[model samples]
Target: MSAAFEIFLQGTPGLEEALAEEARATGFAKAEAVPGGATLQGQWTTVWRANLKLRGAGAVLARIGGFPASHLSQLDKRSRAFPWGDVLRPGVPVKVEMSTSAKSKIYHAGAAQERIERALSESFGATIDPEATVVLKTRIQRDYVQFSVDTSGESLHKRGHKPAVGKAPMRETLAALFLRQAGFTGEEPVLDPMCGSGTFLIEAGEMAAGLWPGRDRRFAFEDLATFKPDLYARIRSEAPQPRPLEELPGLFGSDRNAGAIEMAGRNAEAAGLGGAVTLAHRAVSDLERPAGPPGLVIVNPPYGARIGDRKQLFSLYGRLGAVLKERFGGWRAAIVTSDGGLARATGLPILPPGPPVAHGGLTVKLYQTAALR
Candidate 1:
């Protein structure tokens, strides 16, 4: 098995460069970000580190084995010619997925699957079931079939710690992306006054202390025969120790719902940032800016489409703006919403919203505002 691998990142605003930079920060060399993903050359341990350290990535795909075939007959012949014994054994079941963007005539996915199954079964007498231990993803982008294996079993957002969540919680990946966009580096205080489940705060804490996002999870590729556990172990051993907790600033979160504060506190503890994050059963109107320099206030309050009521959300946005304007002078703010009318309701002079992002299956825009004080 080769040490190098390709990683796929899912985000808006074309963050391939950011993803590649994050990988490099974690010791992955020769990182290159492509259109939808980043390519890095490293050992098997690098694969483990990629999943663990990079917060912006979605999944890590290992280039197991592949051969180019321009036509259906050639695809069958070339696929059968590869030696499956190195990666697949006789007993393991396998799953197959395909993507095509080519001029070749092998357009039918069912036909491609048939050819692959036949080649595997005929060559090795292996029982290739429709459902099995292995998942094979095939991409025929630009007339070239590139097959790879998925290393991450579940979505990397699981993080294995947030067992409970609050209403309209943000995805960890999205939170990280916003942090990067807002130029958050974990060096200053972070406040999420409308904090729900504390995803943003936890991500900030992890960023501050150099905690790997994937440390608690397992990848599907680990079960493959070609996986080298020792290499993964060596990589983990070489990772930098967690940052001293004392260096991290106080992270504060508040919500009107006492239950939400309780959930946020639990999640912070689960993330080992319990001491750094302070969750309170208070409303945003009551929040005071921290003593330090201007800090960040990010809110993903209920929007019209998200909450299914335009009037209610408009009132909520107005109240939210009143609170920020009265209390949080000198603080930078980022408000994410799917409706332009709600953003206008804030009364905070909205900078033209940045890239539209897909959140909760809704196309949302990020409206940035700054405190006059």
Candidate 2:
């Protein structure tokens, strides 16, 4: 339908720069970071490719249209006049959500939402549903009404293949970006000594084996009127064949809990990545570097707010640091923690902190290390 439009790739708060870099590296055109997300300038096909290829984006929004609304009456009139058939088909259900700024005359978000819904229903014969999979996001800022369609139904972190998870599993999108920040390039081994559900290990293995992150999922864009199913299939089919397990370097993980290790194994197997991602049940104290070229060791251990008590975690962090310092030479390390004191307890010469990333309401920072002395 439309030739070209602005594509918004939503990212975590502090990781917008990482998402922008990922967008550019993945061949997106004119990719740049914005406050809440990254923008890519491209056609309809590019939107589809972004949904399928970009690993760091939480959701992709195709900004369809916008207009300056002097008032509610003008907003309704202009919304009806817009060509809704180009993107939204008749009988397709859409849920409208609107946000208004303090400077706008039409200050009620509910009023704007209802007006747009009525226009889509009465004028375009489209169904309006509060529980629809297709979400129409609208923003009213400084009296300007901007509209965008949520091309991604669920967050990209789902990945569609991991049915099992340990407590507080790290999202795949965040894990991918964190791996990049740790300087991983699929050429080195990755070890998650305190791995829970084995997110970091599996994601690293998938990247190394050339597996596409979105192969197992369906996107909301497929339901759009402008969606070209055949073209989308072609884009998905362009992904490379996964490398054999033996050819991939070690992507290893181990947990103290047997149940966690089992669940992580099952999740990796479901993702068709069991061969490249190896999981075992063990404690952080017993962690030994895999026998090969040195690589990056990244882990997300429990913090004070969840899983373990604050006073008792100091020894756990201390043990993890001591083991790494004693056993792993020529290997780099990265630790993520919401508490700076916990990070310091690692005693591994933590590098300068990266920006604080929001993780489940807690702000966590990634502290990395150079090759061990």
The number of the candidate with the highest lDDT is 2
**Model 2 lDDT per residue over 1-373, tens place:** 5477888999998999988988888888579999877997788888888888888899999899999996899999999998888888677799898899999888998889889999999899989998988999999989899999998998889899998877887899999999988989888999999888888988898888878788899989888998888888788889888888898889899999999889889888988888778777889988877889999999999999877799899999999999999999899999988988998998999889899999888899999999997
Expressed as tens digits, the lDDT of each residue in 1-373 for candidate 1 is 4545554543333556666777676667677878766786654556666777778787777676576676788888877787777766556667777666646567777788778777767776667655564677887654567777777767778898897798888889778877877778888778888898999999999998988888887877677666788877776776578888888976888999999988998999998988888887887667766777777888888887777789877777887788778777887778888898899898887778867777887878778876545
Off-target runs (Cα >4 Å) in candidate 2 are none
The CA-based lDDT of model 1 is what? 0.76
Off by over 4 Å in 1: 1-7, 10-14, 88-90, 124-133, 370-372
List TM-scores for all candidates, in order. Answer: 0.89, 0.98
lDDT score at residue 194, model 1, on the 0-100 scale: 84
